[model samples]
Each structure stands twice: as C-alpha cells, then as structure tokens.
Target: MASLNRIWGLIVKELLALLKDPRARVVLIAPPLVQLLVFGYAATFDVNDVRVGVLNRDGGELSRRLVAGFSGAPAFHVTRHLDQIRQARPLLGDKKVDMVLHIGPDFGAHLHRGRAARAQVLVDGRNSNTAAIISQYAGSIVAAFNREALGNGGDAELAIRAWFNPNLVSRWFIVPGLVGVLTLVVTTLVTALSVAREREAGTFNQLLVTPLRPPEILLGKALPAIFIGLAEASVIVAFAVFWFGVPLAGDLRLLYLGLLLFMLSTVGMGLLISSLCATQQQALLGAFLYIVPAIILSGFATPIANMPETVQDLTLLDPLRYCLVVVRGVFLKDLPLELLLPQLWPMALIGLVTLSAAGALFRSRLG
Candidate 1:
C-alpha cells in the first residue's frame, strides 16, 4: 500500500512538472496539432490538377475527341497546345507541363481499319511516383476514348473498384497513420526527457535516497507518459474522423485498447533510452534515432511487403508497425478483435520485453 502511494505521488509530481510550464504545454499541444494539419493537407499520394500539354499532328475528328477527353478529366488540365513535336521539349524541360500528349498522324488511319492505335505520352519522370500516377490517368483517359469511339470493340473493359476508401482519397490513408505516428513521437519524447531532466536538475539523487523502489520509480515515470500519449492519440483520432472526414469504421473500444498497448511499448522504449542518456540532449537525439527507423519500418509511408526479406524480418520487432495495422484497420476496416489479435499480441509482447529491460537497466544504473 505504501509503495503504491509513493508511486502515485511520483506520478502526480511528474504530471505537474510536465503540465505546469507554459512552454511545455505549448510543446505538448501545438506541434502535434500543427503536424497533423500539415501532414493531413500536404502529404498525399493522390495526384490532382496535373498540368499537361498537347501536341497534335493529326488534324482528325478522332484526335480532337481525344484532346477533349483529356480536357474533361478532373485530374488533368490542358495547359498548352503544341503545334510541333519540338515544342513539347521546351515545355517538358522548363517544367511547365507534367506530360505532353502527342497524337500521331496515323492515329485515325489505324482506327478506321480496326488496327491498334498508339498515342505517345511524353511524361516528366522527375518524380517517379507522380509520373506513374499521371501515366495511369492518361492511360485511363485513352481507354475511355477508345470505348466511346469503337463502341466497345477495341479491348475488354476492366472494372476497378476500390474498397474501404471508395474514392481512394489519400487523406483517408495518411491521417489514420498519423494518429499512431504523432502519438509515438509525443509519448517517446515526454518519457525520454523525464529521467534526463531529473538528472540535469540534480534531483535524480534525491529520489534515490527516498524509500521508492526502482520499479515504483519507473512506474511513476511511465504512467504520466502513457496518459499523455493516449490523450494525444485521442486528439489526433478526433481530428481524423471529424475534421478530416475519415470514417471511424471500427469499434472505438478496440481502437483505444490497441492504442493502450502501443503507448506501453513506446513509453517502455522511451524509458530505456532515458536511462542510458546522461543528458536531455542525448535523450532527445536518441529518441529521434529510434523514432525515424521505427516510422520507416512501420509501413507508414511505404508498404512493408515491398521491403527486402531481411528488412521485413526486422520490422517484426517494431511496435509501431503493429500499431499502424491496428490503427488503419480500425479506422478503415472495422477490424474485429479476433482480426486484431495478431497485431495486439506483438505490441503487448514488445511492451512486456521493453518494460522489463528498462526496469533491469534502471536497477543496474542505481547499483
């Protein structure tokens, strides 16, 4: 009972120390909100309003209809019409257009005889991902034109349907992942700084002289960060659903449960880093060093399946990876508890291992 009381008091002190400072309050609230807004709006995979130029050598009715098709797409904007093939060079080189659609003089000739017609699209490949998306959009436009002109005679029509995010909005994918990412950043930083801050302020020795055991002290440090992390995650989740229009398709209870395990893992990692560092600067640096790789490996921006086999194996240990699956699954798929168990157990195991390691390290430091 006394041990619990001591730990409870320490938790209160830690929370107050974090919340009492004006700058700390701002740091805790402002950056995550700002990052959420920035990443939500700015970072996206969906390409829109692509600038394009047209170079038409074939003065045929079919070619004109093809140009009209490009003009009508919401994703594309016809910025320039080139009289010569050479004109496309300057436009593409000057970055004035993403792609130049060239209609060959033989385009109408081949179509009239039921032969295959090829239209060249000179795309700026500087941004490979964007270029690929643009190519797909352009190809889709061409395919539509063929269907209209040929009356379904050219090729078999392909019906593509996107599930979950029917419109395939990139924000739907990004914002949910931000909940895990931003939460990890805040939780890790808060706990990573706790011990270092105490050592820097010359108060760590004062705690050591008290009756509190190492586990109690660690619990005191961890609980505050877990609370703060969950709070931060809640804020992001609210914004993701309410402000960003991302649907909350899963059970809120399941989402929070996953978040709790995720917070435990992150706080444990942070505490471990905190115990090793002698100063706040080292702690901050160390936290980021772990965070950067964790986020990369978490399948946040990139798919884990695309990674090399060795790297994929390495990601098994990243708690953020499992948390992302839980967050995104819950937000988009209405993931049931059974489906989430694989993701959940990994994080719980990681939390258990990291927390035990942190406790042992803290005791060794005390000795």
Candidate 2:
C-alpha cells in the first residue's frame, strides 16, 4: 500500500513537472500536431498533374485523337507540342516537362491497315519513382485508347482492383502509421528525459534517499509518459480519421489495445535510455539515435520484404514495426483481435524484456 502511494505521488509530481512549464507544454502539444499536419499533407506516393509534351508527326484524325487522350487524363497535362524530336531534348533537360509522347508519321496508316503502330514515350528519369509512375499513367492512357480504337479486337483487358484502399490514397497508408510514429516519438522523448532531467537538476539522489524502491520509481516515471503518449496518440488518431478523412475500419477497442502494448514497449525502451544517460543533452541524442533506426526498421516508408536478409532479421526486435502493422491493419484492414495477436505479443514481449532490463540497470546504477 505504501509502495503504491509513493508511486502515485511520484507520478503526479512527474506530470506536474512536465505540464507546469510553458515551454514543456508547447513541446508536448505543438510539434506532434505540426508534424502530423506536415506528414499527412506532404508525405505521399501518388503522382499527379504530370506535365508532358507531344511530338505528333502523324497529322491525321486518329493521331489527333491519341493526343486528345493524353490531354484528357487527370494525371497528365499537355504543356507543349514539339515540331521535331530534337525539341524534346531542351524541354526535358531544362525541366520544362516530365515526358514527351512521340507518334511517328505512319501511326494512323499502320493502324488503318490493321498493323501495329508504335509510339515512343521519352521520360525524364531524374526522379525515378515519379518517372516510373508517369510511365505507368502514360501506359494506362495508351491501353485505354487501344481498347477504344480496336473495338474489342485488342488483347484481353486486365481488371485491377484495390481491396482495402479502393482509391489507393497514400494518406490511407501514411496517416495511420503516423499515429504509431508520433506516439513513439513523444513517449520516448518524455521518458528518455526523465532520469536525465532529475540527475541534471540534482534531484535523483533525493528520490534514492526516499523509501521508494527502484521499481516504484521506475513505475512512477513510466506511468506519466504512458499517459501522455496515449493522449497524444488519441489526438493523432482523431486527426487521421476526422481531419484527414482516413476511415476507421476496425474496432476502436482493438486499436487502443495495440496502442497500449506499443506504448509499453516504447516506454520501456525510453526508460532504458534514461537510465544510461546522466545529462538531458545526452539523453536527447540517445533518443534520436534509437528513433531514426526504429522508424527505418518499422517498415513505415519502405516495405520490410525489400530489406536485405540480415537487416530484415534485425527488424524483428523493433517494437515500432509490430505497432505499424497493428495501426495500419486496424485502420485499413479491419484487423480482428486474432489477426492482431501476432503483432501484439511481440510488443508485449519486448516491453517485458526492456522493462526488466531497465529495472536491473537502474538498481546497478544505484549501487
């Protein structure tokens, strides 16, 4: 009972210490919100409004229709009409256009005689991903035109349907992952600073002199961060759904459960970092060292399958990786509890190991 009381008092003190400062309050609230907005709006994979030029040597009605097709696509804008192939060099080199569509003089004649007509797409490959997406859009436009012109004489059409995210909006992928990422950032920073702040202020010895055990002090430190992390996560989740228009397809309860487990693992890692550092600056640096790699390993921006085998093995220990699966799955896939168990248990295990390690390290430092 006394131990619990001591932990409660310490938790309250920690919260007050964090919330009472004007700068601390701003740091807690403003950065996460700003990052959320920035990442939500700016971080995207979908390409749009691609500027293109046309070199139509074929001066025929069918060739004009092909040019019209490119003009009509929402993804493409025909910015220039090239008189010769040499004109495309300056346009592409000067960054005036992303790609140029070149149709040969015999395009309509070949199509009219039921022979293959070839068109060339010259793309600026400086930004490879954007260039590839542009190529795909251009290919799709040509495919659509072929279907229309051939009147069912073309090759079999492939129907591509996106399941979870029907429109394949990048926000549907990014924002939910932000919930885990921003929560990890806030929680890790808060806890990582806790012991370091106390040591820097010369108050860590004061806590040691109290009747509170190491575990009690650790609990006191952890609970406040967990509370703050969960609150921040809730705000991000709400913004993801309400402000960003991302659908909440799964059970809210399950999502929160995953959040809780993820937070526990993150808090444990933070506490471990806090236990090792003696100054706030060192703690801050240490937190970032862990954070950058964690985000990279979490399969947030890139797919895990694409990583090299050794690097892939290393990601198994990253709690954020599991949390991302949980968050994205819950948001987009309507992931049930059973489906989430694999992700949840890894985080729980990571939490248990890291917390235990932190406790042992704290005790050793006390001696």
Candidate 3:
C-alpha cells in the first residue's frame, strides 16, 4: 500500500511538472496538430492544376479537337496557345508553363491518311517524380484520344483498377502514416527528455532517495508519456478522418491495438535515450538523430522496396516501419488480425527489449 501511494505521488509529480508551465502545455499539444494539418496538404504525390501551353500548326478540326481534350483535362490547365514553335521557346524559358504540346502541320493529314500522327511534348524535368506523373497524364490522354478516334472496334484495352485507394489520393496514403510518425516523435521527445531533465535539474538524486523504487520511478515517467502519446495519436487520427475525410475502414479496436504496441515501443525507445543522456540537450539531439532516419527508413515518404536489399534488411528492426504498414492497413485496407499479428509481435518484442535495456541503464546510472 505504501509503494502504491508512492507510485501515485510520482505520477502526479510528473504530470504537474509537465502541465505547470504554460509554454510546455501549449508545446505539448500544438505542434503535433499543426504538423498534421500542414503535412496532410503539403506532402502529396497527386499533381493537379498543371500549366500547359499548346502550339498547333494544324488549324484543322482534328487539331482543335485535340487541344480541346487538353483544356478539358482535370490535371491540366491551358495557360496559352502559341502560333509558332519559337513562341513556345519564350514560354518555356520564362517558366510560364510546365509543359508544351506541339502539334505539327501534318498531324491532321497523317491521321486522315491512316498514318500514325505525331506530336511532341516538352516538359520541365526539374522534378523527376512530377515529370514522370505529367508524362503518364499526357500519355493516358493521348492514348484515350487515339482510342476515341479509332472507334474502339478491335483494339484491346488495359482496364486498370486500383484497390484500397481507388482515386489514388496521396492524402489517404500519407495521413494515416502521420499517426505513427507524429506519435513516435512526440513520445520519444517526452520520454527522452524526462530522465535527462530530472538529472540536469539535480532532482534525480532527490527522487532516488525517496520511497519510490527505480522500477516505480521509471513507471511513473513512462505512464504519463504513454498517456500523452496516446492522446496525440487520437488527435491526429481524428483530424485524418474528420477534417481530411480519409476513410477508416477497419475495426477501431485493431487500430488502437496497433497504436498501443507502437506507442510502447516508442516509449521504450525514448526511455532508453533518456537513461543514456546526462543532459536534456543531448537527449534532444539523440531523439532528432533517431527520428529523421527512422522516418526515412519507415517507408513513410517512399517505398521500402525501392531501397537497396541491405537497407531494406536493416529496416526490419525499425518499429515504425511495421507500424506504418499496420496504420495504413487499418485505415485503407481493413486488414485482418492475422495480417496485423506480424507487425504487432515485432513491436511487442522491440518494446520488451528497449524497456528492459532502459531499466538496466537507469539502475547502472543511479548506482
């Protein structure tokens, strides 16, 4: 009963320490929410409202029809129509448009004569991903035009269908993963700073002399951080669903279950960092160092499959990598328990290892 009272007192002290400062209170709540809003819109793969210029030497009906198609495309906005190839040079040079569509004089004649009509597309290659997407948009538009012109009589069509995200909205893919990323960041920062701050403030020895045991003290530090992390996760998840309209297709239980495991691992990681650092500055630096690489390797911004085989192999130990797949799966795919177990078990293992290591380090430092 005395130990239970001691644990309660420690927990209250930790919470009060976190809440008493107005700036810390605001810092704890505001940045994660703001980042969620900013990244949801800013980090995206879908390109729209692309500026395009058309130079049509063929003034015939077919040329006008082709130009009409460009104007009608949702991904493109026709910024200007040029009379000469030289006119496009100025537009391209001035960066007024991202792409130029040049239709030759023989474009209509070649089509009427049953010959393959040719057109040229000049694109800004500054951003390779954007360029690739634009190229695909142009190719699809051209292919569609050819099919419409050919009357769809005998040509085989590739019927492409996307599952999970039918419209292929990057937000659907990105926002779900933000739950993992943001939660991990906040949890790591809080837990990593806890022990370091206590030591720096000369409270570590004071706390050690109290009735609370080391395990109880560690629990006191960890429980508050876990609660805060879970709360942050809830906030981000709500924004993703309510504000952004990203669908939640799976069981809420499973989503929370995955979050619990992921948060545990993050809390363990944070505590491990905290036990290692003597000051808060070192803890902050250590957390930042871990976060940047963790996010990169987690397949948050890019596919893990694209990495070198050895790099991919290294990501196996990253809890966020598995957590991302779990979060995204729950949001978009309605992934079953059997599928999620693979991710959940790894996080559990990571949490156990990290938390145990942190406890050992904490004892050593105190000794």
Model 1 clashing residue pairs (backbone): none
On residues 307-365, what C-alpha lDDT tens digit does candidate 2 reach at each position? 55666787899999999888887887677888789899999999999999999988987
| C-alpha root-mean-square deviation, candidate 1 | 15.2
In order of TM-score, best first, we have: 1, 2, 3
lDDT per residue for candidate 1 within 180-233, as digits (tens), equals: 999899999999999999988889988868899999999999999998988888
Q: Cα lDDT for residue 344, model 2?
A: 97
Q: What tens-digit string does per-residue lDDT give for candidate 3 at 1-367? A: 9999999999999999989978567657765665564344434567675788888898987778777777899989998888886776556533477678888888787777666777787764423355557778877887777777644232212222233555557788778889999999999999999999999998898876778877888889899998998899999999999999999988989999998998889889999989988789778877876776678778787555445566678778889998987898788767789878988999999999999999898788776
- The TM-scores of all predictions, comma-separated, are 0.62, 0.61, 0.61
Superposition TM-score, candidate 3 onto the true structure: 0.61
Per-candidate clash tally: 0, 0, 0
Model 3 bad stretches (over 4 Å): 1-157
- Displacement of the residue 73 alpha carbon in candidate 2, Å: 28
